[model samples]
Target: MVRSKKTEDDHIKVAKDLLLASILPNVEFDGWSSGAFEQAVIDSGVDISLVHQIAPRGAIDLAVAFHKKGDELMMHGYKQENFTELKYSEKVMQLIKLRIQASNTHKGAVRKGMSLFALPQNINEGGQLIWKTSDKIWNTLGDKSTDSNWYTKRTTLSAVYSATVLFWLCDDSDEAIDTWNFLNRRIRNVMEIEKAKAKIKKTSFGQSVFSFFDLLQKPSNEHKSGFPGYKG
Candidate 1:
């Protein structure tokens, strides 16, 4: 499998790091006790359930702190509301947008078009435009001058793998096992194609080299031998 257990672990690690960096700068994580923060929300007499949902954990804490300070900075002045509601207010909404954008900026681990999704760096020896590990096998074995099946397979693997990762990240299920199953199946298919191409290349190379030698023989002997004469 191109993305081994190590690769998956790396993905999680990078994701966590990105999340921490993104959320830490704007919101306080552990300056005060959770009870203190909660108490602050209560004292403000504002409702907080709505704000808790849209805000990242740290942002939620900051919102609670803002409420504790009794600062009507929250757009709705509801103090207990969510980030979305604050945005409904003219000034508070801008703060919410800025913070959310900051959070998203740190989300490099997500596999966006130019995100931090890692591809196999050494999959190709010649630095050709390979997108997946299977591409290396097909490119080495298959004839580029003939059918474009390998190109299709390589593209398919890259597409499926990317889709699987995206699904995994968004999977808010019990164990996120659906994404795991998808990942395993995609990896298996890529490996199978690679093995098949390796065999094909081994057989084809032998045939091609032998044909080359036969072509070097005399033109007059071409009629006697089964091999054809080289026009060149």
Candidate 2:
């Protein structure tokens, strides 16, 4: 799998001049379009040495190597479907918190400075991102015995997070403060729901205990009297 020096250099040059050129900044780059670069490698006929010997020129060569080896380049795309589910423990919570923080900052930056380019449609699908956001939110709270209010709060938090990320991707402003403001409101909604659910669960637990004692009540006196006559 190691590419020759010439091959590696060629890929780097191609990426810099062709892919990263001003004309294609906003364009959607995919696997098929990469064939041109590959053909260039084939033409170079550089001796294939050790797999690791192939110098990694840069992102373009890296992508080519990844394609040739089927390695995942980034943490995006359908590949995430196969990503392992993260444990809902303290560590995972910390990771989500980190993501939340990073996301908020990115949102702010995007709103402040807008992009002139459009992201690929595949990346903008709401359903996929919505589910991802919800999953993260659910994992954050996880089986905490929340009530109706908690459910509402969770939904609000997820919706806002998803919306902010979506907007940030396309925002062309110099300061993406709008996205940050939007996210704060959504997070508050989730907090409210969490509070409500806590109260509801407490009430439910108390009622359950009382019901247990109520079930121990004796039968009515009339029924007891009838049973005595039958025994006689």
Candidate 3:
């Protein structure tokens, strides 16, 4: 029987889930390749050939799927909270925290994956993954930025997240308390810069400078495009 498009997506999604579960404990040994995925398919009681149809990129595909699972888990928590009522900085902190906490279940697999991505050949995809993550976080936060700010926000958050994840991987501090503190400090630093910019933009000199700067800025960037994604 031929499957509908929706059915195909559903089938692929279920297979991805089973692959993730099966791969999480074994990715370190197999390194997220087609061989590992084949085992996962077998473990899930599905035909291994389906992997070629659903996700042909092999390890990279599985890694992306794994990362998105964390995004879904994080988004679930974002939905459960009074996120809209929270201050913008608070909301961002919560989003970051949620992502880290969600990864707790498969940190080991992620750690190993990180090492794989760190290789020179794989580094490009690694960077893309970080951007994808920041995109997912912003989407969950309802960001609608479409300018340089969009790029800047994701770029900065990618750095912040990359550093934090590396820290969390080796964090010997109790319950990762140090990691949380580190996160708070990073968020606080960003908030401080934002406040300073806001204040500067309010002054006469600041207004003129900004007006000139705006003239030089990309015309498409009419809306402010960073985290909190305030519309101008």
Candidate 4:
């Protein structure tokens, strides 16, 4: 009997998850290095060749998988919450907090993942991952934007998320209260920027300028294309 592609993919995902579980303890010390991957292969008893096939870039691939896993967990928690009563900014703040809490137990792994992604060669991938997280947050919050605001919103949120994550990693305060406060401040800063834009739009000159730019900027149909900010 021939196995289906979906079956094969599921098997690979399981293998990857096993490897990730086995590597977490080591990641704190090795920072997603080849040694960590090798150790995980031995610990997981997953076929070495299969492990390589699943993660060609070795532990770096697992690091990416770990980040994505946190996103999944965050989204799951988001769905469980009652956000209807919260303001939009409060909802966003809660989402960010949830995302951070998703990885609270694995701060060591997260810290190492940050170091691994901070490498010059991996910087672009790191940025893309953060942008993906921001996009996920906006989509979950029901953002219907298809214009340049889509890009701007994700860009601004990405900055906030990145800064919050860094602050969170260093937060040794009681229950990370400091980090939450910092996140609130960042969200308020973004809100203030939005308020400023609203004020600008109220002016005749600002309206004319925005109208001209709106005409020049084409809406991005991201659903049709895989690229997030593609405007075609």
Candidate 5:
């Protein structure tokens, strides 16, 4: 059988996945270093040089991909949940919880990833990761808003989700019950704000504001795929 050619996205995913796998076991000692990725190339029997073309930022690129991978996993699990009996709020809660929970095993790796994102230059990359994750979450949940509400919804969620992840990193208690409670409260706050905004938008003043917001809306549906590994 002939070997199939890997596309750029395929190359990115394979290299990142392999690198993540290699790093997680030894992330505490080596962190998300080039050495870790090199070991991944050897460990997974993929081309070692491909790591450069796939992720020039090296560890930071891998870090963003790590979060993006979390989004994919969350989307997959979201598709499998029984949404019929669940309230919309419950669905949102479950979606985020599922994401954080699934990656719980790699807490150490995540901790390192978080620290890497905290770097000054990685700020925009961090924002983009959260934005991509938030956008995907809303899409997964069947959001149809094309207005300012769309922007606010994602903005609020990125804050809530990012805060919850930070809280989760420190909570060593029984099953991170504290973090879940915090997450629920944060989501509730956003929901209440949205409820108010919904009522307000029916008024003339709100409509004008919304019209202005519409002007500020993104022209394209495609978000900036600023992840170094992303080709599209």
Candidate 6:
């Protein structure tokens, strides 16, 4: 019997998951190197040819998958919590914390992934992943801004998230209180910038400048047509 496309996809997903699980301990030692990938294939007992077919970029693909899986876990955890009473900034803080916490078990892997992505070739990919995480957080929090603010919000939060993750990786504080405090400060700084922008917008000169810039900026939805100059 011929398997459907969905079945083939499902099989590949299972193989990837198995390989990912097998790779975790190895990543702790090998830092997502080819050696780790080879060991993962052997440990998973998956055929080498099939592993290559699924992960065309070898361990790089697995590292990307690992990052995406953390995002998925963070989203799942977000659904289980009650953030109705929290302020927007607090909600943002909690989401970032949740995302970091999701990878607590495999911090070694995260550390290794960070090193891998920091390479010149992988930097853009790493930056994109950070932007994607920020986008996810904002979208999950029900941000409806389609204007320049959409890009602004994600850009600011991406900085906050990246800084927090780096601070977290180094934090030896009890219960990581230092990292949380650091995150709070970063969020506060962002809030202050937002407040400054609001104050600026209230001024006549600021309004004129913003108006001029707004004319030059397109809404997020307009980028779907593949415009060359629209930077979103």
* Two-way lDDT contest, 4 vs 6, winner: 4
Candidate 6 ranges beyond 4 A from true positions = 1-6, 216-232
Taking the tens digit of each residue's C-alpha lDDT, what string does model 6 give over 102-205? 99889899999999999999888787788888878988998977667777888889889988999988888998999999999999999999999999999999
Q: Alpha carbon lDDT of residue 70, candidate 5? A: 82
lDDT of each: 0.38, 0.39, 0.75, 0.87, 0.77, 0.86
User: In model 5, how large is the Cα lDDT of residue 175?
Assistant: 91
Q: Which candidate order results from sorting by TM-score in descending order?
A: 4, 6, 5, 3, 2, 1
- Predicted structure 1, TM vs. truth: 0.27
Better of 2 and 5 by lDDT: 5
Query: Which is better, 3 or 4, measured by lDDT?
Result: 4
lDDT of 2: 0.39
List model 1 lDDT by residue over 1-232, tens digit each. Answer: 5864567546544443343334333333333334434544444333344334323353333422222222222223333334443222222223322222222332222222122113353223111221422343233333252234434455564465446646655665665566556665665676687677667657968567544544443224345232211111
Candidates 2 and 4 compared: the better one by lDDT is: 4
Between prediction 1 and prediction 2, the one with superior TM-score is 2
C-alpha positional error of residue 197 in candidate 1 after TM-score superposition, expressed in Å = 0.7
User: What C-alpha root-mean-square deviation, in Å, does candidate 5 show against the real structure?
Assistant: 3.4
Clashes of each: 9, 20, 0, 0, 0, 0
Instruction: Residues 39-67, candidate 2: write the lDDT tens digits.
Output: 43344453334212453342233333322
Root mean square deviation (Cα) for candidate 6: 3.8
How well is each residue in 1-232 modelled by candidate 5, as lDDT tens digits? 9999888888667666776676567666677777876666567665657767667776667767777778788878877878889888888888899889868888888888877778897766677777767777787888988766677778888888889999999999899999899999988998898899889989999988877887765335355344322224
- The local distance difference test score of model 4 is 0.87
- What lDDT score is found at residue 129 in candidate 4? 82
Q: Which ranking of candidates, highest lDDT first? A: 4, 6, 5, 3, 2, 1
Off by over 4 Å in 5: 1-15, 38-45, 202-208, 222-232
**TM-scores for all predictions:** 0.27, 0.33, 0.79, 0.89, 0.83, 0.89
Task: Give the 10-residue window scoring lowest on summed lDDT in candidate 3.
Answer: 223-232
C-alpha RMSD values across all candidates: 24.8, 19.3, 5.7, 3.6, 3.4, 3.8
